[model samples]
Target chain A: MTAAIVALGVVVGLLGVLVVGLLRSHADVLRALHDLGICEDDLAAAGTAEGRRTAGRRTTRTTGEIRMVPGVAAPGASSSLGRLVDVSGVDPHGGAVHIGLEGSRGLTLLAFLSSGCGSCLDFWRAFATDEVEQVPGRDTRVVVVTRGPEEESPSEVAALASDRVTTVMSSAAWDDYDVPVSPYFLLVDGSRGVVGEGAGGSWAQVVDLLRKAAADAGLALDDDRPRFTRRDLLVGRDRELRADRELAAAGIEPGSPELYAPLHAAPGDGADGEDGAR
Target chain B: MTDVSSYGITARLPRGWDARIAKRPDPAGDPAGPSTRAAPEEGISTRSAPAEGDPPGPLAGTEHPVAHLANFPLPPVRGDYGSGAVELMRADDIFVALVEFEPEAASTPLFSHRGIPRFGVNDFSPHTMQRTIAGMCGAQAFFNRNGRAFCLYVVLGSHALRAPLVAQVNALLAGLEIDPL
Candidate 1:
């Protein structure tokens, strides 16, 4: 009886290993299907397995960071983002306002901008216009966050303040949001934490953000017309091409980032090392 | 004047000055380091560095011009110079550097020498070359030829030595010529 028990234990161990191996193979098949762009609804399209596709959302790679494109909310999208913290900053009207990010009844776009950023400057004119009062979606609000101290900021930044857009200059709010680049956009749902974050260089890019935010919230814009057109996208692309030409005309290759980085100095920093009368 | 040819270009060395050319390997290799020894006349090596956080080692002791030729590595930014080799020639109280850099396809804008004195040989006129101050330097010559640019940076030990080194730096700058393949 003891000899038979030892043989039975060996057989059971082999069965366990086989089960684990099968489970691993099944997981591999599922991952391969996801990589092939087979959604959960189409898992049985190719006569493959009938199981649901893994719920992992595809991550879009952008400069310096990975961002998820707007799509069906992946599992635990809300739980993944922690709560937003309250930050104190000064409004454009010189009033002290606590930005709790909770008072917005609908979607709120926090546009992180800087007076020094060339990209942010491109959208300043559009931002100063009356169109900013009605940012495409219903009940959505747009808030501009600039670095604090009104006296230290450029006049162009101050020009962005109007009835439609609320301009706040708060270094504390900028740090709290962990924004590293200017012309960055954060779409926040009312008390729902961050819904999406992206970098925008122009007003069209901002419009693009509104469109994506509206889509994800299962909300439709009151206006059927799209703010961005094929020509508008091409115009943005042309700006980059023109910059390359100017650099090339200067005999500096636009492709060399290291060389270009040094050539570009902040205004009044003096690219040339020597001062006057040297 | 001694005619020194390297990297498909020819440059005139200072009357008694010597130059050792380092070439880029065909298959590409590491950038030139501080490997070349000091010349017998210069009586200095390029291998010395000050202890961490210390002021430039040799200049610490005296105000008098010292002849200390040290090997300084190429700067972090690579220049148009084929082999990024650099050396600091400290003669008496003057600092002279021979640097090479690649020229970009776009023309680098020429700066106006409004208040500064401009001096250069006829050889540089065709190349849009000019003499400008490099931050209290005794004199500085910047010129680009044959898709490469050269900067002859000279800092005199004292204002007293300015007159003596001015001619020497100019002659060295005039001697620079591009070797057309």
Candidate 2:
């Protein structure tokens, strides 16, 4: 009973602060809350009114810098040996045993990713479920390149490698390969000397190419585009959704509403800015 | 775009012909100017100070890429030494443009400026290289360097930005201009 009374006093104290602070600060707490899509009642309930106002202002400021990804300038040149491959932690698949590109498999699907990249995760999960033997025109072998080492758990590596997602931790993916954001895929054709690269966002695109190439090489597998549903957006198979979540900190900003909506929906904010901030 | 094959002077254009002109900040004073409304955290209201015609300091003269190029020395690659002020006729807006001729291609290039990326630098493909400039402002200013001199393309932008963009670009590039290649 005492605990309940203390909680009520605390709530009343918070309410007093939020209301008094707004009147004194002249802060536009209402618009900020609306922009964040936070319900009014929830703000009222976040303890003191000051708490809600602070929360609202903080959220709005964060949303300001996120704009869409600029379009690609050119189809970059196809990477050659030094142009694509970097040995020793360059393309790690979690904790999977390192196999040199010179191994029986001379090819590596250089998938560049970040710890918080959404598109990279989408591609990773999709490729796992799909078969590799029957792709019509692409090769079947694969390797992963990622930025953050601390975020890569051994279990995550083991899970992806079970389906052959060999991970390589390499800064060269960004420094040498020109991967600015996460999920940039490079399909290395070492023997023929051609590294076809496109759409780093989706692993399915990579898998589809691999399947097709394998089929052309007399290896056949049933691989198709993995159509993602709304449910998949919430708890995706891959954890790179962290990038999408992190973007809320840098996405929408307070500006002319009409001009900003379009930018909020661009890449880096995650699939058309699905984070509700867009 | 005219028949100026023997032209000796540098030319420029504005940006308004193509881009959407953004409305300047509200008339209640300079929108970009400091707001009378103090941020809630600081609460430092300076409205009571002097009613000067414009905000104070060196900010008055420091404007556009042309101004920056004035003090800057000739880049490793340049056709001439001079700066210009190019505004987009369509936008009538204030902005700065930084242009460089192709590195591999002749320092003096040529073309009509159009599109986002504008032109491919390495490929030197005509108008095929257009991409938006990230972190700066609108439009990428790539020059087709396949083999042509760079200014030949500056002549092209002279017609495209419609007016302001090229004028501003050339004004900055003007300081570095020499006799045309």
Candidate 3:
């Protein structure tokens, strides 16, 4: 009996060591995956409806919180913001093209995508099919930038390019922007430099992320209403003046008792009978 | 202004303007040898048709550099003289093409001008366009610079509005520098 008890203790200790070793290996694998821009949580959440709903709520709530705390960089904020400059590269037809980012009006959306990335395929399709719309109210120019000719096949990029969009094959732009992943995006305000940037798994997610970024930057993304100009303000002032002139002509001056008549019929003041005040 | 230089061509592009310098590609299957084609009477031909049983002719007798500058966004794909992008220009936009020619052509009478020619509003004409675009006017000049032959082609989006646009063009030309081969 003494020998059996000792053997059992040794077996239990070995099992505990084995479990710890397994956990250590699993953690190392997860860390490696994270370094590759993949998180196990994201992978698991990508397929479930509840996870997607939760992600949407989280994005909205986080954006609201960011608005409350202006100028504070959110956790995991991308470093690609404010790094975009002029983008120059050879087109698929071997022609050199330069796109100036300075002094440009409206927003320029730089979509840094790759041809072989599985996650980028959906974005490519969305851009090609016009499923993605420009940021509402802003004249967002979408320029699809791919790796240079040496690293990417121009033919494949051309095939993936949309006629409506301007595609530039520029590996230098990728380096200049310091893109961390295949399907990263940078939103630039020509006058203000880069305002927002992040990675998105789908077109919808990208739009959400961009909208949130724009909001955090204090940009009115949904404010499509016509801007109130100086002329409008002048017209409003003129209308008010005309109304004041008419009121004065009718004997209603600044100190007119009629303006305060509604307040004078109160019970505390005793300006009228109790029944009238009531 | 942004300084854009490539292949010995340099230009200071103003704000709202962009430029690109590209070397003309060699004729397919044509081995490196002396070009057999003769220089065309005109200094530049916007479009040339392949002659039957004749070797594909290089523009102005050899492959040369072409630089395009415009106030509007230039598309990735464009012809030697701004085909795809010119159509997208607004009424106030400007497109400039600085095309180089063979060194020998520098001595030809067509390219005898000493330096880049300055343009005035009267220099632009609607009929000068490779393809006549409504409300658009174009001007072309052939000149020699540092033993190099070049053609300057400028297009104005509006003929009536060419005065200010011409001033912008001359300002751009004033900043252009071409290095000797």
Candidate 4:
């Protein structure tokens, strides 16, 4: 009987705290509305379920646009794989490895990555799952070149160690080739010559580079365009929807809806002054 | 023979003059002279010749290539020199250099005298090339072309060659062609 009485007292105390908290939250909202000079009637309307739902819809309607800058079109990128084979590093199983034109045979895709880089983590998933060998017309191999001791690599990088994907722990190759930035790529031919080199700012750009290299080698690519994953699309959509709702709630109008859309160059459209920042 | 086609500027050579593009070597490897951004260790010292049997550093026994009219190794080679700036012309006591920098993302006072937003080196200072500028005048100018910033630096040691070379430099600037952004 005493135990039952204690349980009842605990439940009653929890209910009282919750009720007081709700009342305080309502009072705070009303105070904010008063500070904003909202009339009592308008405040009452905002408190209604219909008014709140309409406000939410309006918030979603005010969304910002994000446009991707077009990547550099591949030049007449022919193969000139380097004949000098500079040894990059030992593999995970303690085997020697060569990258780019330095390798003995096949096309070597050199990926300059760092464990601390956020972008590398983002695109690494796509890169790992992409059916690189099925690209037709070339025997492609991927090698990741990074810095520091192999054992000290982050979990994301350490997970990429395998027979298919060789990881190196040195920047010597990068310095030798004068790679300007991280996540850069160098495509090499069977004869150890450079086919093409470019910045891998996005997974799409990297895929496009490889496809272009394959195409330049006179091989047809089988719909080689990089496609976003289902998760990527869903997450992106959710973020946009949230942004629209939040923007509406904050009373910020979406600036230039067309900027959020894909850019289609119209006839005689002068320079957009967008390149100035890039 | 001063038609330097690189960096989109064409410079015509005056009679009895010739020119070729060359990358500037690093002082650590080739201490031939100091550059505009030369470091403290790259002192304003006289060009030194190495004693016999001395191992080669970059400038150990080699005379200044421009002064002696010899070939200087091109850059993009590790531990040699910067890959950007190149010696466009070296004839008599005059040296013309050209450098190209990637475009700036936003126009933030990249150059002086022009309010126009552009990209490039705004803080360039002239460095004395001891071998070439023993007794001469040097000047550098900046401009934007083809969505890249270009630096045209001229060093003239002989007073006799300055006027003619200035005219050639002007001609090079006049014939410049930059693709629209």
TM-score, one value per model = 0.32, 0.26, 0.57, 0.28
Candidate 4: Cα lDDT at B139: 48
Candidate 1, A253-273: lDDT as tens digits:
646664746656676444222
lDDT of 4 at A231: 84
Candidate 2 lDDT tens digits, B34-147: 211111112222122111221111111111011111111111111111112122111222222232232333332222322122221121221321222122122223332233
Residues A56-133, candidate 2: write the lDDT tens digits: 664664454232344322233433323533333321212111222321123456666554545555655654554432
Give the per-residue lDDT of model 3 (tens digit) for B1-181. 6677777788887765667776544446323222111122235453332222221122232257788898766655566667676788767788998878778878877778788787766768887776788999888777888898887778899998776677677767878888898
Superposed by TM-score, candidate 4 places the C-alpha of residue B98 at a distance from the truth, in angstroms, of 55
| Cα-lDDT of candidate 1 | 0.44
lDDT of 4 by residue, A1-278 (tens): 99999999999999999999999999998888666555467546667888686665433333311232443222222322443334244333222233324222345677777666666764556555644443233345566777535433533344543323446665566566666556667766633366666665676667776888767765444645423457867779745754553333223456856447567766533232222211
Candidates arranged by TM-score, highest first = 3, 1, 4, 2
Docking class of 3: incorrect
Candidate 1: how many backbone clashes? 16
> Distance (Å) between predicted and true CA of A141, model 3?
3.4
How far residue B168's Cα lies from its native spot in candidate 2, in Å, is 66
lDDT of 1 by residue, B1-181 (tens): 3344444545444322323232212122222222111111122232221132221212111111111111121121121111122222122222344343334411343212212222322211111211122322333444444544444334443233343344444434455455432
Interface RMSD of candidate number 1 = 27.8
> Residue A225, candidate 4: how far off, in angstroms?
22
* Best-fitting candidate, scored by DockQ: 3
What order do you get sorting by lDDT, best first? 3, 1, 4, 2
